[model samples]
Target: MGRKLQRIVEAAIIERIGPVTAQDLMAMSDDSWGLIRDQITDRRNGKDGLVARCLACECEVYIRTSKTRGIARPLFQHYNGSDPDCPWFQGRNIKPDAARAAQYQGKQESNFHRLMCELVGELAALDSRYIKHTVGQYRSPTENEHGRYPDTYVEWDDFGPFVVEFQMSGTFQTEISARCKHYEREGIPLLWILFGLDTATALPQSFIDVIRRHRGNAFVLDQAAVAASREQKTLVLSCYLRKPDGRLDAPKLVRFDALTVPRSKIPYHEDRIVGSRLAEIEKVRRPWFNALAQWEDRYKPLRDLARPQSLLLAAAFSIVAATNGKGRNYASEHSNISAMLNTYLSTKVLSPYSDLLKQIIENTRSSSIIKASVHDHLRRYRDAIQATNESPEWILLRKLLPEALDPVLREELAYLDALPDWANPTSE
Candidate 1:
């Protein structure tokens, strides 16, 4: 939604419960989102009134509806301002005498080297470009020195040599200077994107004079412009060229930052709450199943597979599987619920995996992820794990299963076991 439609959108849409509209917001990663313009809630009777287009770019948006389909895509795309000096390019025409240009390119290349060293765990270091973060000083470290690589980058898509350095929120001059020097010495090309909440990076004349002294190109990323680029998904794997004067133009933007949420946020609680916040999540998420059940209704015809639903289901599970004094007691005393809830409000609201709230329950019963936290999320789905530990279902589920009963749903089995003698899974 844009500045004008903000209030109107607030009025029209009902989240996670009714028919989702073209204007609703969709989760990108845990950190960001892209709004849908002309969203296609349903493609009815061989014709279409549902269309999602990006407001900034005015591009059409689409989503994949099939639970068991291939290549499902959301229709909104976040606009990342174009990279006037991104590291992906090989440099159009190298001039032998343009030594400064070569030096800048080297800085870009070295920065890519550093970025990959950081991103290596999850993404491919092909062309050996990725970002590595560290204390602004002291001994430097590389990703390789750490351990096994990251799962997302290793298994899924690849990485590019260009690394994006978000100098927003925390770009202390000292830290910036140190990081820049590190890369400069590394002789890699870097896309130094800088910005503040108020606007894009327009380096001061003094700053430009300083950059002119450097061997690299720095660009600024415009958050507002990027937020407006919701044509297909909430975000993109792209970067932008910030005007040195810190001004932003809507059209010449780049979309970047795919997989905005880390794998860590996954295996999250599917069913968090049934309150207003949850309702808002649903209004944007609402897309009813064929059974005529509201998207929020638990008894829809199909099994719960949406990521959002899965998260809720996981929370319901935690209500039973909880134990006292065991895990992150994000909620314990009623006073604490506010803090925990706030965390969700701040983080879960914009997370792409938040959608996993729908698909999480299904994933919990799955073998795709082997981490115990997945079980933990499901274990304490209702409240905090530690709080729910004493839940009736938790005790019973543990009693019914053998030591580690993962193959068959140990939780479900426990529920069945807790039933009276007349009722059992065998009865099914």
Candidate 2:
């Protein structure tokens, strides 16, 4: 390979979003690219953010912009401190602090940022429930750590304490993560408001980071939001909801109190990331569940749908649904799930799925199938058939029942604190 090819990172794997190449990055929409760019920054900072690692050397990588004909393009670049031995290493890189200083030119806070902070504080104080509001003041930690200088701090009569940080220019991912963790540790609601959002054609990576932390709901205290707050006697924000296609919807004026504050302390009106994804997964499986519930003949519907592996999936899902207390037998007309499983095992239809079935049974709620009878049946039929993870049936099952099958996804969901109850295999 040439020196340039060796230096070019061919691909990278982003946490939660899988693999992407330079071509993939170029194909992404502006908003999508912005989110990936911010996530790369976050991963470089620490373990708290989405991790993007080079597929070549498995070292951390970030998105670097290269301009061609006045049009900016993105490519993956290893971090400055990454392993120098990696084939994709691009010579020496500048330190993050130096780059940040050059970008800001020693001006950490702009006048517009200060003015916005004061204005947000003023609007927050308009509510009758507002007890006190402060701007650019030190907020001492309630516990053992040192305090932080929040842009705006507000204490409500009944709603409790809140902190608002305004995004002006080039807020580092480490700083953002530290502040979020700090406020969450102190049990204070932290809200990040964006400035100059109305004028930007494409959002900067820093703004994208904040928007994603708010779960795809970007809040801006713009002129219209200011007027709305004045009329409503409370803080109002111009909320822009991100669509699935990585584009923003029309801005809507939302009251500060109307936001949904998750456990992360970052609030949003709607969850466009996690909630929407789960809903999509449900939508994909709903028809299968419906077909299974109303199943008359197994060979016709399961075979005619899509993959030949649907029969195994339907059988597995039927067993799981029965254990979940749904009490519907879709695999067979047998009186119980145990009978259906035994029949399949004897016929070698579910023989390749023994291991998969055992995992599902162990993860779900208590059941008669958990008794030794089922295991005995599985063990008896275990030697009769070959089971492999490389099979299409196994792969499909992992995608269909990720909460139960995919350990990496399970860990990711648990780390986000969004693991559903059905996915909790150890609930017993």
Clash pairs detected, candidate 2: none
Candidate 2's C-alpha runs over 4 A off are 1-105, 108-112, 136-149, 185-187, 198-200, 297-301, 305-311, 319-327, 332-349, 358-389, 406-416, 426-428
List, residue by residue over 332-400, the lDDT tens digit for candidate 1: 222332233234424442132222332322333222222344444433343322213244433432333
Give the per-residue Cα lDDT of candidate 1 at 282: 35
After the best TM-score superposition of candidate 1, give how far the Cα of residue 212 lies from its true spot, in angstroms: 6.7
Best-fitting candidate, scored by lDDT: 2
Alpha-carbon lDDT, every model: 0.30, 0.73
Q: Which candidate should be chosen as best, given TM-score against the real structure? A: 2
**TM-score, predicted candidate 2 vs. hidden true structure:** 0.63
Q: Which residue window of length 10 is worst by lDDT in model 2? A: 103-112
TM-score for all models, in order of appearance: 0.22, 0.63
